[model samples]
Target chain A: MAAEIKAPAYRQFSIAPAIQPGSMADTKTFVANEKIQEAIGFPPALVDDWHDRAIAKMGELLSKYRSFKVYMDACVHCGACSDKCHYFIGTADPKNMPVARQDLMRSVYRRYFTIPGKLFPKLVGARDLTREVLDEWYNYFHQCSECRRCSVFCPYGIDTAEITMAAREILNSIGYGQKYSNEIIGKVHKIGNNLGLPGPALTDTLEGLEEDVKEATGIDVRFPIDVKGAEVLLITPSADFFAEPHIDSLIGYAKVFHAAGISWTLSSKASEAGNFGMFIGNYQQLREIAMRVREAALDLGVKRVVVGECGHAWRVAYSFWNTLTGVGSGAADPYAMQLQKQLDHRYKQPMHICEVTWDLIERKVIRLDKEANDKHIITYHDSCNVARGSGMGDVFGGQFDIPRNIIRAAANNYVEMAEGTTREQTFCCGGGGGLLTDDLLDLRVKGALPRMEALHNVTETHGVNFMATICAICKAQFTKVLPYYGFDRRTVGGVHQLVSNAIRLGDK
Target chain B: MTMTTLFAALFYLAALLFSVGLIYRIRDYARTPAPLVIPTTPAPRTVGGVAMRMAREVFFFESLFKGNLWTWAFGWLFHVGLALVLLRHLRYFIDPVWDWVIFIQPFGIYAGLVMVAGLAGLWARRIFVDRVRFISTPSDHLMLALIIAIALSGLFMKFVSHTDVIAVKNFFIGLLHFNLQALPSDGILYAHLSMIATLMIIFPFSKLLHAPGLFFSPSRNQADNSRDKRHLSAWAAKLESGK
Candidate 1:
């Protein structure tokens, strides 16, 4: 909460944000406490022989994750991905460069794993795994948002996110946990959500939401929790219950579900969709968090599982949950088979809320009034994880189209940011990859520069008042950082917020 | 050892290191487990599509084309020209000059100049561009310089020095037949060969492994089927069994 904006306070707004190299080099996140690490099932404190253990973990990862291993050897330093990182573009720290950041770990990888680094380390840019190297790993690895924008332009598909994850995993293995992400993961394990909000509080919040909706609209709009035999169980980020703008999207989801006449309920046991386990790059922790949803769905007897608008959570739900739990295709796996058998085979295992909304709009299951949002010209900010990591609807690029279609149905005026900044080449909100905490405010502000500049363009040219995104982190980041750049903090809202305001409730 | 014997043994040693070391590195990459599907979308979903993507990346430097144009131009030139030159050199290894090699000889000669041009452009950026310069290490510059030197020396042997082509062919053929023969003694020819030998020795151990690493990269090569198919690594599978 003590986080404040640090900058050339106000950057000269431009269509394309200027690259200020090394602007965020010294930024560091708060270190994790023993309790937070212990809660997430890691070593509670830094070990005496952390260096040895760290190297051993890297060795283990090298064998376990092929992306980490191949990428370690793949970089030719052709400098293709050097300028692709939004952090590097915003902060200008040479280390923020994707290639340079990977070298932080690659150098050490060369030293121990490859033959030449053991012999002539300098000749190949390889270095030993010294204490200084580990410190560099922590600082620069956390600086990366894991946005995967760099991988879009990387000739060899060397995802710095994969490397960043591998580095953080290595750091965590040595008991050097990042406070923000580790603490959030701990809260998630203890209370079933990141904010540590209790079940009774969640119940109260849903009740309040129901009352608020009824007050706003003359009709009774229901927001239910733990209703057995519900066809769909909606798992949203807990921030939807606790935070602003995020709560508005929660309202939107309820409206869409209400109009579509789906029997849906929220589960206190699986109230969270955002998984911080991914931020630390721990598979065990990631699996543990995913299991909550699987268990909740089976217990509640929900045939269809729908994930709410949360970025990396969507990626985890859309991509990893199938294998991590038994949500999707992984039900074919013997362990996953039990849960898979319970899930309705008629629907997509975990449908994205956008996909569900888009489907209803397509089939005329829900009619929407575009005029309700006439006062607002909206532009969609693609959340990096959802844009790059997950797909929507049925096709390959339904991820990009479905949300935009839903927006077009909900609003008359829509404009795209610059071609490169949209779709697969989209920039990070600068607050992703677990750097959304207050300790990294310096970076969070700077990182948002590229994205804010893009948003600034839409406002200037298209009279766009709202920048809608699906991720809670992006909403929180833009809402927080927009004020520093002389824009209203209310400029950022969720994609569903647009849908909520425009849905025609009176019609069949 | 005599000069012919020494050079013959060196080439053999370099070839052995290059092939065996490259195989070991490639094998390591192939064996590593990719636990999740992480293709950078919109990625090809099928095997043929992946091959097409790889082809575009190799032939056109598709991703680099999306990045900086200057980097792409120079990078593409060096790689494509290097391919031509390598193919052109196949004339020396084959018994009778292959018709394709003979046909490409003129273009291959031009490709040597293009290779030098590409290396010069790449090396200049290393010194001039702030971001590129910052990320580049000492070896990065040296790599460009080493390739430039090889290109320049090879060009000299082609146009300026005129090394004994027949003798070069005989020497390689003899070497291929396990019979040592006199190598062309031109200093430029020796310089080109020595640099090439050095490059071969470093291929697997250096960042040059990007050549083989491209094929194994999970992000590029993976199908975006994580939602539709369950991808579990060997270690991850073990975790489930343990659970």
Candidate 2:
């Protein structure tokens, strides 16, 4: 009877990472390994021969820093950092211990690199670096969301996330890397976006959405796709184009635009705002993607670029965007990164989608009809990458509150998840760090159980039928996991979706 | 030569080594910079719960009280009793009499009892617990043995032997003020002094340095609210402007 319940189909399409630039050809050649690599192309790595290259690169990178030497010198394995983890605290899994989690990488790193290990070996739990160890590194290191939460509690401030990131980079250098990240990087290199669906495809998607809006409301909404003189270039997750929940967000964006009578365009060149390289410690690729998006904005003559609901996408946009371009590249200011750096002193422009949404409501440009979204009981899921990751928790807290306010304006009841899942203590959707597309479903499901459990608690108690989120990937993950955990799909939608449903479509 | 003078000479030399060594080591630490220190949650200054945090630390050992309650309980007891014993020993340094030191003697003996019990509990915990045993290096076990030995020897002089503490006090006082002194004729007291010297030399290099460090610890000392705000420390500001 249990076997009759079909193993839930893992949703791979909507949340897959952007692939690498020069990695697809290598993925094509291998036989059995190729099948595994192709099965989850989001986390693309070199097939069979990748291990040799990884080992060589590990030596070169390890030799460059005294920090790794210090890291090797430290670590008493007191296990002080184990139970402090939210996952371990929530799950009570023994292997989720931070010291134990890090031992997977540290043991291999010691065997191949350190002196005592190369000499005595057995005294320090060090072992010979082998293909098996590399396999372990691939499995375990990717499990970390690179959240930096564990480091907060560690007495030594020893960041296991930093070690995992370094390990991922070492793997990437050897051609063992994520396919989706590589693909997106390749797109950034070639067409200035991760979505590989280039300028014309983006325009077509926008134009089609325009027609959808026209049919729904009888309002002639023009989604300006790369209009040269536009004041704002609105960018968002690639998932919003075809994905169910975020499409409603796009409609909300259109309605807001119509009411404000503001000139904005979806950049034909840089349609997708997410940069997955930020997750894998490939700072160069991260910078390159940001550069292309900024270049598109500059070339098309938009004064500002507003990013959408993705978390790490906003992090890269806010944190690294300015530093990597302009003076870092010795080029003229690209507008977006420059605006962020001098938020107080720069041009009186630059805004995120959430900010713009609140501004439209504040200006009384868009009048929302209160009865449209009154049927379902909804609650907000704060994206870690959005709230804390991008250093916009306060800003997005207010912004996220605006969406819930709009929902409450439509309906009297909106709820919050458990204690630690809001404001300063929000949890990451298990699919963060391009792990959403990696072939680690068992790990992802187990890791995401906390979030699913929290959501389930809300549903059982408050009859929360609607799970409203801002990020596109959050929408995609919920759509896939909610049903497996027994929550209906009709309950999940973007913040903009609620806004679109409630806002009067035409002249009120 | 007078026996008292010999005692003073020996006492002065030991005191010189301890005071100078402690100060030198502390100075070195003060000069060294700790560049990164990430603060954790519910730090003393930041907890918003209705209960006072210090009350929790004193009563519950809130932060020190961890998932492994038995080990943590022993650790907390050991630390509290050890701190009191050290304070009681301060009587040796003062000349004439500080009324408070004499007042605290009975409390000191009680604290010693707690320390002995806590040390035994911790030693047993290290031996019996599976995960603790697995991660316990030989050095870890050896360090515990050294601490237990020191604590027990001190406890013996206090409760069992009842050695001539007057002579010991005189020796320590002469040493603190730089009068060289000979050992008290009691061999057990000499053994206690020797054990204490060994512990002092080892203290700087061992995990026992956590005693002084726990106070400076960014996790424990600083406010957690600083992370959300752009907190510019004076030193940080000076460095930035200098750059």
Candidate 3:
């Protein structure tokens, strides 16, 4: 089903394509079956009263999330964010425009919530929530990656991602949920990871990785899991255990911990760092998913919780874990205070692996032989969640700088992509926000256009052979979609993968 | 009913609706719980820094400036000019116009021209730009038209069809003091005042709520110190307690 779709070509400049109305209207993702929905505590199937239920969910969201409430009223339709969305830029679908994507739900919001729409609907572009509109919501809201790129450009900080989250939440409440996000979330709840890898399998994979690393470097670097009293509990995405490029990053983290001599262990209980509850925008589920990590930390008695190279996982860990599960300080609740007292107050709780690696490099605790990566000229792809949604170190924009600093220290030659396509303005890898499943491979390939263009630019200008990122989704998405765009699958990898290539393993 | 009495009644009603409606909407926004810290980073980590960020967004249209130059130029000009024109209009309500208001009288007259020109550019973009045109509803166009119409008519009274300025001032002062004063009988003057009344009455209900909504927007106004300060909302706190 995905093969027939072709990749968009790179132009001389990143220009906005002419509006193609309904170009992507038929591009719908797979819907959650009754079982998948039921697993996640959503309605098993579309309810008879879905129309009313959807509206009620939206009202609940408006009162609960200020982002949803203010964004609904703040948009002036000035089109400042029209061309900012990668999906819109890639597909040229008018509805893919952040403002238009927002209007699908906004129109319904106006009809039900606002006075002007109640009095005169057409004039304000408000419409009743018919089944057709619900289907439209399902199709278009899934099309969004919730990357928050448009929010950066909007005059009022009108985050279309917030609207997308709310729309998905409302859809799920009424028994219309996307299969990819719901299924993974259910897996996280049931088996502690998205890949559903159990404790034995996780242990086997780590032992295998340790053997592979020892064979290469002749050093006894360990991939310890479920080890109680470890100083740090490393919670990473399950992709690292099973997938290419991501596995290489997992190697990097282990080597960093070994060279620095910091006692760290992976927890099978919280094996997965990626949380799809965020993608579906269900706070209860989001908190519930985060609680697994808390449980792991408490049971293991780890002093610090560190997250690995996954974008949204970092966001959930860094920005949300503190509030969601008391991973950080300042929580007055009993559960939070208990966890807080156990954690080392000196270190940032639930720290990014990049922060840990960079701190080691800065302190000269870990030495790197940069010439080991001499064959590859690297560029960093700022993961959308990390770039726009979360921070790394104490400094503002440490998320951007820390990753690049690691790359520069680990690899001698590094180049940045075009200005706007890097840093806070970076494009999404398109497979983020729960669109990483194979069923949406066509949309994934199409949405990769903007970032692919930026990469192509650097390849042409600098002969850049490697694109380093700090996201499992980015690495996975780019690996699969790079071939479609005439680039090598190996072109995209993790920042730690480069660090793994260059870091001095023993007695550094 | 006399023209003076009819306009007086309309202005009072418009004022009442604008004040009450705006207060109600602002209160609703203030009361709503923001469950999590979702500030668009690299955001400021301090409250003062957030205030500075908001100030830049309000005064300089910082995000829009980052977004599109054409939109920012026109939008900023319109807002600044409208502010000057609004301040100038304070001369009507004040018994003895302040020294600064008297000082900026000529600039205020010129600002009216600037405001309309800026609105014209924005309206033209709405009509011409494909993406903008696609997103714009009739209300968007009408919102632009309404403001532009008010600006144009106000400009017309100053430059083209001259009205009795002293009598107009006296009429506004009379309305404030609960006394009736004769309004100047001019077509442009009536058009200008009534359009303003219409704008005020619709301000709280329409997308003009962006003015207050911007202040409440979590992404812009929030400090990015979520790690240091645990921000647990009431509903979310209940969930924790329940657990």
Better of 2 and 3 by DockQ: 3
For model 3, residues A1-508, the per-residue Cα lDDT tens digits are 5448789877667789999999888888999999999998999999999988888888989888888998999899999999999898888999999999999999999999998899899999999999899999999999999999999999999999889999999999989999989999889888889999988988989899989999999999999998999999998999999899899999999999999999999988889999889998999899999999999999999999999999999988888998899888877778789999999989999799999999999999999999999999999999999999999899989999999999999989999898999999999998998888787888898899999999988999999999999999999999999999999999989999999999997766
Candidate ranking (TM-score, best to worst): 3, 1, 2
Docking class of 3: high
**Ten-residue stretch with the least lDDT total in model 1 chain A:** A8-17
TM-score (all chains, Cα) for each model: 0.97, 0.70, 0.99
Regions of candidate 2 where Cα sits further than 4 Å from its true position: A1-93, A105-132, A152-158, A178-184, A293-305, A319-351, A359-365, A393-411, A421-423, B1-153, B162-243
lDDT of 3 at B195: 93
On DockQ, the candidate that comes out on top is 3
Decreasing lDDT order of the candidates: 3, 1, 2
lDDT of 1 by residue, A21-79 (tens): 54555577888889888877778878899989998999899888889988998887888
Task: State the TM-score, rounded to 2 decimals, of chain A in model 1.
Answer: 0.96
Give lDDT tens digits, candidate 2, residues A1-508.
1122222232332121221222111111111233333432323445466666776766654443222323333444544555444344333344455665676666666567654456645655676667766656665566666655554434344456556766777766655655555555666556656556777777788889888888888888887886886877777877777678777788778777777787888876777788866666664566566666766667667666677777677656544454443311222323323433432223222356766766667667777776777787888877755554343323324534655665666555688988755543556566676666534444445455656766777888998888777776667766765666677766778878877788775565
List candidate 3 segments past 4 Å from native: A1-3
Model 1 lDDT at residue B106: 96
lDDT of 2 by residue, B94-207 (tens): 877688888888899889889878878877765765434545555566666776777777888877888777767777766666665544676666666666666665454444
